[model samples]
Target: NFATLPIVAIIGLTIATMGALTSLPMFWPLPTALLSASVAAGGLALINSIGQMAGFLSPYLVGWIKDQTGSTTLALYALAALTIVGSLVALRVSRSSAVKVAGPA
Candidate 1:
């Protein structure tokens, strides 16, 4: 994920910059333009900072799981299978539950 950091940063910056630039025509006053830009930049920074922190923590978690299991491949395969089964079960549960709420809609 560290390798993907630069790409993510660039994407975040582009999104924030474009958002502020696009809002320039709508906001009117110069103060509003500056505030819009500041808001966009702040939001982007918050989101990307959280993502970056998660990226760093994920490796440590994977390492801990691998240490417990002795094999990262096996751990990953086990997790994948469990995830598939969980998703299927969740889908069924959701479908059944939704049936109870499906009234006249």
Candidate 2:
């Protein structure tokens, strides 16, 4: 299922639009829009890449822990801890990095 195109598209679209991204036209205020779009794109890519890496690594980490300690609970706890950390980081980021664009609105 890793090579599923529709699933990948859905995930990509969700990540991209999760930040309220939009295509910018090439014109006057369009320049500002383009800049905003680029920033959004970069942020989305960074977040998605990190998320994907974590998703890919988690199972491997769990397997390794299970192999060594013969217990999956520790790995699960580690995953939960990571999730909490990520959530806290996201909350701080959302509060600190609010972007404002002034053109007509």
Clash pairs of candidate 2?
Answer: none
- Tell me each candidate's TM-score: 0.34, 0.60
Clash-forming residue pairs, model 1: none
lDDT of 1: 0.57
Q: Given candidate 1, what's the lDDT at residue 70?
A: 72
Per-residue CA lDDT of model 1 for 1-105, tens digit only, reads 213588886887688579756754543332222334546567456646965886587667668888997767665555557546745764565345332223485
lDDT of 1 at 75: 53
Sequence-dependent TM-score of model 1: 0.34
Question: What does the lDDT come to for candidate 2?
Answer: 0.63
Best by lDDT: 2
lDDT per model, in order? 0.57, 0.63
